[model samples]
Target: MTAALTVSIVVPILNEADNLPKLFEHLHQLTAKPQQIIIVDGGSIDGSFTLAQSLMTEMITIQQSAIDWQVLASSAGRALQMNRGAALASGDVLLFLHADTKLPNQAMTEIALAITQAKWGRFDVHLDSNKLLLKLVGSMINLRSRLSGIATGDQAIFVRRRIFEQLGGYPNQALMEDVEISKRLKAIGKPACLTSKVITSARRWQQHGTWHTILLMWRLRFDYWRGVSPDSLKRHYYNT
Candidate 1:
């Protein structure tokens, strides 16, 4: 087997204590180990920080083959937290992961090979919901991403460290930073558009009705593309 590439997985999290165990479990089971994993905690009120620390401690003591890891506390905001984590990353590639997402099998090796072809890329997404509507939503999400060369954070966006730096990192927006960054990356080169999928929580869609959430997302994207301010779109998104 080929050696694992040097990948720094950076996760921006908030109040994800319930999800950390599963997330870390998958991280520990990677066929190709990451160079390091950085958890950027966005001031979670839940015990997420403690849980992550405990998990890291346990991995250090029990695992013979373990990736280096660290937990950083940052102000609340996904874009801010992710940019901060990337600044501290040391690997050749920086992967921005959402806390509620799980990478598919061999995702690490896939990313390593992917960055060789493109400056950045994202895996397709699978929503962890059995609802037929959500399954279709997942398919559309992947198809839209593939057609547009844009990626979302839930898709586990990865990029060469130097290219990420060249783009000045993700735009410091209240929301839609991923879309903005993807646009900039696409200007330089098309994304790899890997076939592997990352399973992400469908909590938002479940909290709202599936169709309602889908419409809201479509509206948000249209507004964003039409030059709407992210701050305004963020208010509309969470309020809906």
Candidate 2:
């Protein structure tokens, strides 16, 4: 019999203690468990790493679950943290996830199936907000990613381990590393474009104002595509 493919869910986080508990709850309930859950901490002062480790210990004590979780420290950058996590992963596939995003119950199963057909892909996303504009934004993001072969980090990008290594993982960028990687991957093949949505926190949009965030994102993308350096864009992103 053929061995089943194993997946490593790699999450890069910084100061996300508030989101870790809910993230772990969804992860532990996954129907198709990953071979390992690698959390790469980017110098969080908020005890996020301790919280993650404690949760794993709790899972083992309470349910006797074999929780294969690794918490590693790295430089404070999402791309750097993820690359570190990917290096330590021992699975056939790598799933890059955001700390504040919650996967659907069937996400692991869907990802396992999708990876068989395509080397890389991302799930659709639903923002956690009742605002109609947020709903529309989510729909547009899904549709745009499907049609343009590009994906945002909130969508939960996954890739074959070998392919990821060949692509050199995410670029060393201060921002828009997701977009940069998507462009490179699309050159090789179209993504699986899974329709099932992963629910992500709408806090960014909510905090910045929906319309304003939307316009800002578009401008960032345009600037990135027009040859603006990620460092310059990163400064602009945080300054605004």
Candidate 3:
């Protein structure tokens, strides 16, 4: 256990074995130190837990038997998992990271730096797809981050833990939790955007067809804005 900062990095996963090592290494590249790295595993069958154990022995300072790992049955949706992660986090600032996203080396310094200046912030998103349209979409996403302060899960939002608890945390939904919580965060205060962006896999779009996925997401957003339940939205979506 290193000196704890005001920030904690929280991540949730389910059968993401292939990507976990990269995520942990990228977490090393990330900004904050042992701000409590909370890993919420939702019943992985492919030995992802075993890998998390093996990897923890390297970067983390926790005793082998006392690593900050929590395993849940796959019943808790993404929203629930995020909330669980937040509860276990000990930092004043809570960071929500996706399993497939990679952060830059200077992330923690930037995070602490931003905490002094703002209450909340999110990294800009860079998708790992080679498609020209995806590049365009990434530009639009950056623009959205700038204009609306609405960064998706891949972008990773960090906020003071007290503020998160005061605001009642994320809405438990299968989808749209990021958007909903971000709306609340932006309502309380403007969030800072870091130049150190997080890169995400574009496997979902590639598998589902970029245009189709884009259209579906657009529809989901529209429905969410109109107060559709997240569970219903996720029921309609074929996830990543």
Candidate 2 matches the true fold with a TM-score of 0.96
Query: How high is each candidate's TM-score?
Result: 0.96, 0.96, 0.88
After the best TM-score superposition of candidate 3, give how far the Cα of residue 96 lies from its true spot, in angstroms: 0.6
Residues 1-240 of candidate 3 have per-residue lDDT tens digits of: 224455677888888899988877766644445456777777788988778767766665533433244433344577778888887777878888889987766676778778777888899888997889998888788887799888788888888899899988888777888888888988988899887777888998888888998899889999988988877888888553
Candidate 1 Cα deviation (angstroms), residue 88? 1.1
What CA root-mean-square deviation does each model show from the true structure? 1.4, 1.6, 3.1
- Output the lDDT of residue 49, model 3: 76
Off by over 4 Å in 3: 1-4, 29-34, 61-75
Provide backbone clash counts, one per model.
Answer: 0, 0, 5
lDDT (C-alpha, whole model) for all candidates: 0.90, 0.90, 0.78
Candidate 2 lDDT over residue span 1-240, tens digit each: 014888899999999999999888888888767778899999999999889888878766765656578889999999999999999999898999999998878877888888888989999999999999999999999999988999999999999999999999999999999999999999989999999999999998999899999999999999998999999999999998
